[model samples]
Target: MSYREERRADAAAQAEQNRKAAEARAAQEREDRRLELETKLKAKEIAAEQKRRDAEAKAELARKEAEAKRRQELADKKVRAQEKERQAAARRARFGRVAGWLKANPATLFVAFVMVASIVPAVISQVGALSSAKVHVMLAALLAAMLEGGAWAITFMGKQAEDAGRETRKYRIATWLTAAAAAAVNFWHGLEAYAEHPWVAVVLGGSSLFAIYIWDMKTHGSHGKTREERRQEKARKKHLADRRKHHKEIAEEADRLLSALPFESITEEQAFETAWQIKRGTQPGLSAEIFAQVTGARVQLGAAFELGEHVRPELVRAGMLARLYNPLPGRLAEGIPTLGPSVPVPALQQAPEGATALAGIGVYGSEGASEKACEKASESASGNAGGNGSRGRSDEELEALLPKALKIAAELVAEGNQISGAALSKRLGIRRDDARRLRDRVIAERKLKLVEGQADAAVGA
Candidate 1:
């Protein structure tokens, strides 16, 4: 064969080898894809199995938790039932204890019974009284209860106070007052409702007082204040009330004193007395400062009396002197307003003829005084100048600003913007007069330039 045919044969073998290699490679890739698909199928099956197992486990857990919750609820119900039984037993025991106490204290039970029985009658009587007065039913009932309840409350408090060995005077007074008011109301009610029978009204009215009286007597008996003692207490209370009314500041001061001292170290009266001494300066009615003023005034009065001893003679002498003088004296004292006003001078007139009083001083050649007067005049003139020396714009500044203002005006005109004296004033920071002058110069130059331009144009033509 030829060399070209050999080269062609070698190239065909290489191409054939490449085609087989590419086919083998494609077959291997197809096998790899089949294995990968099988692996994904197995993984998906495993995941599905895991999800089924997790769902089963969760369902079992929920069933177990439900069973546990059922058992817990049963236990809680049993506990509540047991607790209810225990509470029932406790209530019974408490009721028995109260029954035992009531049985043991028959007298106390009887007293309670009596209180109830008495309360009903008194309350009914007072309520009836109030009802007859045309009060509201609820209000009448409340008022009746208040009167009866208040009286009994005071009576109860008095008993407690007696047991505690405290003063029951206030309680006794309060109870009696409440009882009296209630009795009066009942009396009025009965009298108004049953006008024919006074005894019925008396009985109704006495009913309110009778119960409270019994309670009061039982509570206080002989332990209460004696009549004399009560009178003394009332007098003492009046004295204190008067003191508080008349001297509120002093009463407040006394309270401060009482607070400052140890508890119960002094009585209220003692405290008030001490405060009065301190505040009123140990005087009952008058303060020390006021006393001092009064004494000082007395001393001044005595001094005035002593002065009168000698002043009377002087006064007599003055009267004689006054009588000796004539009413119209020829000579007038200088600078006295009542005597006559000082003479008003005529308009500027030349000094009367010859030598003036001060004229001779000039003839003596008072050069020092003249020099001083001239210096004063010059100083006054300098002072006046300093007082009002606000200078106007200098000629140079005005001239310089005038050129600048004209230039600015020309620019404004070129820009088709108007220029006026006020606008020039701001541009040059000059006075209105200076700005007006500058603006006028600008207008005059403009006219002159215009005229010159016309003349030139005419000449050229």
Candidate 2:
């Protein structure tokens, strides 16, 4: 073979091999693209299935929610219906009770009917349901009904007042006037409605009068009260009188007990403590008046001591001597002269230094001179005799005067008057010491709480 021929054949063979290889490569690429499209289609089907399942779940949830909402609404409706039924039942019961009461009270029922009917004519007129002439007749009927009802009420009231022992003249007069007016109105209306038959007017007027008479007879009969009822009333009055008498006796006893204490021997503090103890120990509680009496006795004793020392020194000295010597004799001889329980005298040994003036019958030399000088100075300072020679008041007398003094003090305090020793002394006609004790007693008893400056202002005023 020629070399050129060989080259050309070899080239043809190479081209054929290249063509076959190119076709094989194109077939493999077409198979790969088909497999990729199948995979994409499968994934798309899977996603569509998942989306449909999600939609079904959402729709089911919504349906369940709607069902729950419907059930709740039904439950609320049932609750409301039950509440309404309960309210209706309560209203029915109340109405039944009212009907029973109205049925029992015929007079009250009649009055209620009249009052309701009185407004009906005006209502009919406003609604344009009645002619002018008919409206006037209705109004006249209403007036007659009102007057008759009023007369009945007044007659009943007068009878009740008379039964209760109250004056009934005014009620009787009102009933008479009302009955007359009712009869006149009824007769006038009857005549206007039935002019041809005069007997009708007379019958209407007579019927109203008869009704009033019947009501009066029913309310106020000849045998109004039985003998048994009268006896019971008398017994009740007697019981009340007995109760009043018992209370008065108890009060008197309490007053006596409160005033029985020897206030002159005890200090104010001791007296108050003893009084509180007695009050607590009392069976039937003590009255405020008893407490007032106790306070008054303490104040009076203190006042007598202070005033007697200055004004009636002789009496004070004699009282001191009696208190001292009387105790000495009892101490010296046991059971000597049997005297009733006497006020205990404080021992001279307990007296503080420089207080020998306070000892009974021991004021000598300078002490006596000082006491005389003090008496003269006080007498000159107070031109008034300081109530000299006046005997000390007994607890009973002091207690009797206490109420007026307390009332005055209360009035002064209520009027914004500051309470002080001086104010009390001047207003209550008491000595300064008595006023001071009274003020202290009131404060201790929680009757008043005066500020510091207020008491000073009261003294200056």
Candidate 3:
């Protein structure tokens, strides 16, 4: 019984042990599966967190890009707006200037408007009239322009001439003729178009002429000068012509000056005045040769005055104020002093044999009639003038006049004159002593080639 029971119990224990081992293996496998699942879930969670952070960073970058693009677009728009405003301001300034100019010249604008209006219809009419087989339409269209162009060209020339102070009458006439030609063409066309309504032809013809007349009025009407202005203008023109005609030298020099400037900044008169100062040396209307002659005459007068102081002392005592006294043959009544220093008192009559300083003066001719008269009258007039004499000088006069006489003597000698002893005595009617003494002094001091001969024997010998 124990064996059987023991065997069954052992079997039972073995069975139980097998069952417990199976349960333990199943529990360990289940735990291992649970651990693997948990590890996979944590790994997946980590991956998902990293993807979320990446998505957030991508979204932030996109937002910043959008914000930057928006800011750049706003800046570009602002720049465009500023440029548009500047352009608008420039346009306003330009428009304002144009308005100012239009307002300033209303008459000019009106005239220009009328002229343009007149030309357009005239051109169309001309083209219509001439656009047949012979004339091309383009060439015909240019005909009205040619007519108006000629008139305006003449008008322009007239204006330039008026501004330069030139004659504009011919230009005005030419301008009128040219305008009339244009007006005639227009009238012919107008008449052809409206033969029954002549006023329409008149209007078409007068429009072009009227336009040109207004321009002529503007150019030539306001230049009428008053009397004084006209006088000055006439005088200036005459003076200008005279200067050109009479003063050719100055005009040539002025031409040179004007050429140098090339633009003609200086007036002809101004250039002539400068040239006059250069060429004449003196003021205008005076000559250098005449002035020099006047100067020399004054010098000779001074020399005569200086020499008169050395007359004889006896003559001074005899009521002669000057040392020398030789009154004119008839003017002794005026007092010897009253004859004045300016008169050309003849020297005492010299012997007629040789020439004296006064020779060839034409005052006394070669016949010696005046000399004979002087000597004859002096012989009767001495009264009691001096020893041996008619009217004589003292010996004292000779010594005193020597110093002052040198220059006079030198001048006389330079003039081809020689004052000998007899010539001195005869010229002054002085006592022989003083005449010979003074004459010898002059000859020695001036080194003159004069021979003093026997004086009283030498009269016309």
RMSD of each predicted structure: 32.5, 22.3, 24.1
- Which of candidates 1 and 2 is the stronger one according to TM-score? 2
Candidate 2, superposed: residue stretches over 4 Å from native:
1-20, 54-58, 65-69, 72-107, 110-172, 180-206, 209-236, 239-461
Best of the two (2, 3) by lDDT: 3
Q: Between 1 and 3, whose TM-score is larger?
A: 3
Tens digits of per-residue lDDT, candidate 3, 136-212, equal 87787777678878888989898889789899899989988988987887788778878999888888888778878
Deviating ranges (above 4 Å) for candidate 3: 1-49, 120-145, 149-174, 185-202, 216-461
* Model 2 local distance difference test score: 0.55
Candidate order by decreasing lDDT: 1, 3, 2
Model 2 Cα lDDT, one tens digit per residue, 319-404: 56646554234543232222211223442223222222112112221223334443444444442222523343445644565666
* Residues 1-461 of candidate 1: C-alpha lDDT, one tens digit per residue: 99999999999998999999989999989989999999999999999999999999999999999999999999999999999999999999999999999888665676566667766877898888778778998999998989988888888898889789899899889988998898888888888878899888888788877777655545547468899999999998998899899999889999999999999999987888888888876634556674565444434432322222223465334334433452322333222222221111220111212111112111111233333333343333322211323354566766777667768877655544334444566666665445545655665566567668778999999
The TM-score of predicted model 3 comes to 0.34
The alpha-carbon deviation from the true structure for residue 234 of candidate 1, after best TM-score superposition, in angstroms, is 37
Candidate 3 lDDT trough over 10 residues, lowest sum: 358-367
Name the candidate, 1 or 3, with the larger lDDT value. 1
